[model samples]
Target chain A: MLKVENLHAGYGGAEVLNGVNLEVKAGTVVALIGANGAGKTTTMRAISGMVRPSKGRVLVEDLPVEGLAASRIARLGLAHSPEGRKVFGPLSVEDNLLLGAYRHLPHFLGFRSKAAADLKKVYDLFPRLEERREQLSGTLSGGEQQMLAIGRALMAQPKVVLLDEPSMGLAPVIVQEVFSIIRRLKEAGITLLLVEQFAKSALEVADYAYVMERGKIAVAGTPEELRKDERVLAAYLG
Target chain B: MDTSVIIQIVVSGAFMGLVYALVAYGFQLTFATSKTINFGQGELVMLSAFFSLTLTRLGAPYWLMVPGGLLFGALLGLFVERAAVRLALEQKSEGWILLTIILGLLGFSSAENIWGRDDHPFPTPISSDPIHVVGVDITPLEISVAVGVLGIMGLIELFKRRTLLGKAFEAVSADRDAAELMGISSTRTVMLSYALSGAVAALAGILVAPITTVGPTMASALILKAFSVAVVAGLESGFGVVVVGLFLGGLENLASLYLGSGWREAPGLLLLILALALRPNGIFGKASIRKV
Candidate 1:
């Protein structure tokens, strides 16, 4: 559903993503695991057109989308839950979710009614979000905010979702809860490209996995194949 | 001085102050999305008023002219965004400041060339005849200003709260990047804001034209005071500008009454300086809290 070929991107002169190539076939979860600065986030940003790739081709279901505006990429069926859970702090949870479906819904009146079904689906996924629907998102706890982020991305009903560090700065218990949500989403057949620091937990949920090192794919295989490899076991699983 | 006279002066001044609030609200609209204000906003007001006056001269009625004038203002706003602000915002530079100022200067000269430098009396259907309420006499012309300013502001506030597009606007204001992730284009939102701001500025010009007259320099003093209103009230709150505008309006009138006509402009400047020195965020503006 999503493909990147020879992606190169960076901040100003410092290149962070160097010829990174990866793919996630439809209806499967792909985990990108690496240490800090492995270019996981940069890869996600380049795919979503947040950070313009100096050299690369990003294709969403065969439509080349590299160098398009982030907003344009979003409209073309890519939802990016960026690192740091960048929710609109002043907006209510319901409003945030409603905005996640912005491209599909009407711009003016009657949008609430049209978005009701999508809202219900997300609310069911995270009951806590429904409870605090009217509350400002910024005031939510880190765990709830993370759920809100995932829930928001789901609201888009996008062709592919890029989940970036869903467990970052979360409690262990909350991290487990987040992983369970991913499992549930996998069962529902959501196509996702997940970026996670928790390699073990990610591999458990991912059908396929890629280990990134210094802005390139160091290893790639099924989770079981990766588990049997010594280099993958020592460098990441250890 | 009779207490009734003081009330009369304050009331009249307060009506005029509503115009300042309307213009300041224009500043708030653009600032909400872009974090930049058009320094040439005064010229926008002047130019829009002149355009409206031309419509009047072309034999259009007040109702027709109002919408016509607002449309012209909205177009001018889009032009300003395209010509002055968009490039700077895209490059992430502060060049918009000088660019907008130059646009304003160009607008000023354009008005001089098109309409001449002389002030002309703005003809209006609304009567200037004062109607007495208890002891205070208020003109229909002034009442129209109050009604027009409040009506537009209330409509805009409703737009922000009730509509999905408006909510998108607020989302962009709150966080530009996050809004983009939702497929809400910040550039379009910013353009919409400028259009709204321009329309609001045009309305201010049209409302005040009968009392102040239509001319190239008509909005000079008005825009300065409106700036004071925006700064003193804080640029974030709609309600803040009205309260500050009214207070500044009344205070200036009282200052002129007691101190002298020469001291009329003093109070607004004083309030602006005091607000800037003491509370730079504005009396109604909340201090932003950053989370690491």
Candidate 2:
């Protein structure tokens, strides 16, 4: 559903993503695992148009989307739950989810009724969100915020979702809860490109995995194949 | 001192203060979305008033002239954003400060060239005759200023709180990147704000033009006081500006009455310096904690 061909992107003159290539086919979870500064997040950003690629192509459903504005890319059915759960701090939780479906809903009135079905599905996935729908999102705890972030992304009903670090800065128990949510999503057949620090958890949920190092994909295989690779086991699994 | 005299002074000054609040609200509007305000807002006020006067002189009815002036103001605002703010913002440069100021200077010269430098009396259907309330005489023109200021502010606040597009506006203000991810364009939001701000500047010009007269230099003093209100109230709070604007207005009038007309501008300056020294974030502004 999404493909990146030799994408090169960076801040200023310093290139962070150099000749990186990957793909996420429809209805499968693709995990991107890498050590710090391996360009995993930048890869996701490049694909989502958050960072403009200096060179190469990003295709969404075979349409070239590289160098497009981020909002334009989103309107074309790509939802990126950016790093650090950057929810609108002052807005109500329900408003955050409604904005996820911004492209589909009406701009002024009756948006609530329009977004009812999507809101219901998201609430069913994370019941806690329903309980705190009216609360300011910034007041939510870390795990709750992560759930809000994921739930917000799902609200888009996008064809592809790029989830960056769903487990970052969470307690161990909360991390487990997040992964279980991911498992549920995979079972529900959502196409996702996940960038995660926890390789073991990511591999377990991923249909396919790409291990990145120094701005390039070092290995690519099925999760089972990645688990058996001695180098993958030594570097990531260890 | 007679208590009624004090009330009369406060009542008049408070109404004038509402004009400052209105212009300050204009600054708050653009600042909310783009973190940048038009330095030439005073010029915007003067030009819009001048435009409205021309509309009146062209034999347009007062009601017709108001919307015409507002439209002209919104277009001028869009011009300012496109010509000044957008490029600087895209480059992540602070050049907009200088650019907007230059544009304001351009506006000032244009107004002088087109309308001449002399102050002109702005005709209004609203009466200037004072009606006695308790022992204080209140002018219909002053009452109109309060109604206009509060009425527009109320409508905007309602729009922000109720509409989906308005929610998107707040979303951009809260986090530009996240809003962009949701397909809400920050550039457009900034444009809307500037347009609203320009409309607001026009409204202020129209509402106060009768009382202060329309001239190139009329907005200079008004803009200074508006700047003081925005600084003291914090750019984030709509209600804060009204309260602070009223307070500053009253204080300055009292200063002029007791300490002489030379002290008229002193209270606003003092309050501004005090707000800067003691509460840099403003009394209503929440301290921003930058998370690394």
Candidate 3:
């Protein structure tokens, strides 16, 4: 389980996440849907230890990870597949997947072979990646790049996976494909925290959803509950 | 002017440019990894040269100096990464670019005090005897430089391809936030890049020392030339940098002979300006586009 309580975060002096509360229960998919700058990304950053909360606590399996470095937090099995598909352009598609298992290298700790096996599993998930395994990632099409991004994250074998705007800039068909992958992850019993601007699509797949506005949560519920809510429909589902 | 003299200047200028590309390649490494520029790079070269000279002067076999220079260079590189690069990362300021420049100034000036800043002839390990290639007299020094820089390029390629750490460097450079999510340590990657930068600078320093001079200001021209080369090459393409480095080098030499020596800096700088104006991304650099 992951918990963020009373979280406060910002860039420079402008607060982006204020007293925000959220959680992803084990084996559940929680989609955080919001307007632009509604603190969805900021909230994810805080949870993944990318940004330190000015005030709050982040508990990973009840372990304090609020102010820890991201790598440290990642060891606790929380991995974020960031917005904008930040795959290494010059490296091969295969190498990009390998990098997602970086913490396993240099000490093995029985993780090297495990990471290798997990990487092969990622290749299975995205066979196009395996076909273009030797090609430089930078040259991949946007849809392929998004697939590569999710594939790379899965290589980490994370306990809780965070996706920020995976559907951004991708084609409608590709977006549907990516959301299908998210849906599949939930089917596989993985805990997921997804932040998306495409609220309607996100809530459709989200088991539990939160609608954020101006750096705070406006509403929260199960997918069915939020789907029927008038405010959620008017403000976010549109 | 005689044809041979013009040819000599042109050939030498081009060869010198290859050396400049070698130095600039160092800058490209750090810039790619962390987006932090190490202004002290020139001093790193100069210091390496002095290390080589001191070792040779101490009667250490010339063969020992190669690895000796590289080892010493690597240490200096590790030091710079820790002391200078770390400061910039901690402050979250690219402003530490000035810190590296200051480090270079302090380093170069202190070296001047220690080594007296006098022009000292360096013994070239390879033959200085001229060999004619295409009716042009080229020394073993130029050939060695061409080989040395090319070797460095090959090695860096291998590092990025074959090594686990090199991929880590690439991961960090591609997207630091995403890299962290993958559990990649940014500090380690940046340190690795800087160390490689220092070594590259040292490689350039050691090779150019014999051709130019072993002095406190030994690498100043080399550093400036590298800056120009990197600017023209778009600061991204490593091999592209080497090609541009050689081209500008040759162009400068040709310009100096046909027009005047004063026009030497003019062409390289002009090329840099023209490149930026036409393709701000650089001759070899690809533009980065944000998804959102």
Candidate 3 lDDT score at position B48: 91
Model 2: per-residue Cα lDDT over B1-292, one tens digit each: 9988998998899999999999999999999999999999999999999999999999999889999999999999999999999999999999999999999999999999999999999999999999998888999999999999999999899889888899999999999999999999899999999999999999999999999899999899999999999999998999999999999889989999999999999999999999999998788887878877
- Provide C-alpha RMSD values for all models, in order: 0.9, 0.9, 3.5
Interface RMSD of each: 0.6, 0.6, 3.0
Candidate 1: residue pairs that collide: none
Name the better of 1 and 3 by TM-score: 1
lDDT of 1 by residue, B1-292 (tens): 7999999999999999999999999999999999988999999999999999999999999999999999999999999999999999999999999999999999999999999999999999999999999999999999999999999999999999899999999999998988899999999999999999999999999999999999999999999999999999998999999999999999999999999999999999999999999999999999977767
TM-score of chain B of each: 0.99, 0.99, 0.94
Candidate 2, RMSD to the unseen true structure: 0.9
* DockQ values, each candidate: 0.87, 0.87, 0.46
DockQ for model 2?
0.87
| lDDT of candidate 1 over A71-98, digit per residue (tens) | 9999988999999999988889999999
Per-residue lDDT of model 3, residues B175-239, tens digit only:
77777888877887788888888888888888888878899988876787788889888878888
Instruction: Evaluate residue B217 in candidate 3 and report its C-alpha lDDT on the 0 to 100 scale.
Output: 82
Judge candidate 3 at residue A7 and give its lDDT. 91
